[model samples]
Target: MDAHSAPLPAAAMPANGFGRFAGHLDRALGGLVETVAALLVVVEIVILGAGVMARYVFHAPLVWSDELASILFLWLSMLGAVVALRRGEHMRMTGLVSRVSPQTRALLEAVAITASIAFL
Candidate 1:
């Protein structure tokens, strides 16, 4: 509080309470989904590989391999949707939208979020 005291840098300031908690939840959820996806992919690959090797070497293919792989693929794809949200890698026409007013931007964002949620 002294006049001569050096000001703290922005990074040294305490994080916004809500923002910090939101970030923590986001990271935790992302990590959990990532782990599940990884495990699913690994399991599918191992099972499919084993099936292929067995079929080639012994002329025996497990009937369940294809079904198992398909189920895993579907589940993985669904879980993978959150990855795009987390990465902020979605495609958008920024050039056109950048010139819009803040109110319009907020409206567009709300509409987009609504549409995305409805679609899912």
Candidate 2:
């Protein structure tokens, strides 16, 4: 059978205690990241709106709003990335990997993860 049609190996299943705990942790962290990203987006919108109102309607600019909005946007983007990664929704070029053997795929994934950790 091809990789796509093959059943997942037993080791790939999250049936053990540590695997369950890790899954729960990932979900919790993903939820937190989503919540924080949403809040940041709201705050950014409010700050931008207030800044615009103050500048055009009141003829006085809110000097700090722009900087605050930028910071909020940065955090929002980072948190969104975390959420995407947790959900396995992040962009990837998987065409070549999909055609490889399972062992090779696993090795490549391990190396990629290690490189990511080292880079971080």
Candidate 3:
């Protein structure tokens, strides 16, 4: 068969052992991150809305709402970052990287990944 039409070898398929378990774990973690991030955003919105209503309608501002909302927002942002990283959607210099050769691009990507891990 032509190279372009050839079927992939058995080895090219997904793993059937520990690799499969790892894939499941990765998917579970990703789902958890997305759920937590979405929940935090909802909480932040509700808290802020409550605070606004308390101040204007009830004439009683929620003293703790701002602090709680800020904390939730921080958590939401961190979780969102995790989700973005997992989805390969985190911010990067893609415009510059796209101009480089494949080898250089790979090296740059490795360096970026290492730096990200170190920063984390």
Candidate 4:
């Protein structure tokens, strides 16, 4: 399956306006982060290209060439994580929880989220 086709567990059916808007906001954030990350990738590529040209042709690499590349990659990864979380794209283990009643499911979800945060 493609990246966008990955399935997500049905969470508490969002009924209220706040819930719906929150979902919308999440999707918007995901899109925005993806756009920004793509632009950053282009910038990284250009800089890396310049580094390669200078290193081969001029025989002098910039002092901070490797460090800059690492920082750009790190930024892309962190932004990608935010995008994944917003899209519910993280690997979620919800098999057993799917069989439970809504209330119990919510409780378990809360507990799991808390544990995840604590672990992080």
Candidate No. with top TM-score: 3
lDDT by residue for model 2 (14-108), tens: 89899889878877877887988888888899999999999999999999999998888888878887776565565555887788888888887
Residue runs of model 1 more than 4 Å from their true location after superposition? 1-19, 91-108
TM-score of each: 0.67, 0.71, 0.86, 0.62
lDDT of 3 by residue, 89-115 (tens): 778787788788878878887998899
lDDT pick, better of 2 and 3? 3
State which candidate has the highest lDDT.
3
For 1-120, candidate 4 gives per-residue lDDT tens digits of 322324554475476998889878877877888999999899899889888988999999876777898899999988877677655565555677667787887787688679868976
15-89: candidate 1 lDDT, tens digit per residue: 999867876887799899989989998999998998898888879888888898899999988877776555554
Off by over 4 Å in 2: 1-20, 95-104
Candidate 4: the clashing residue pairs are: none
lDDT of 1 at 18: 80
lDDT of 1 at 62: 85
TM-score of 1: 0.67
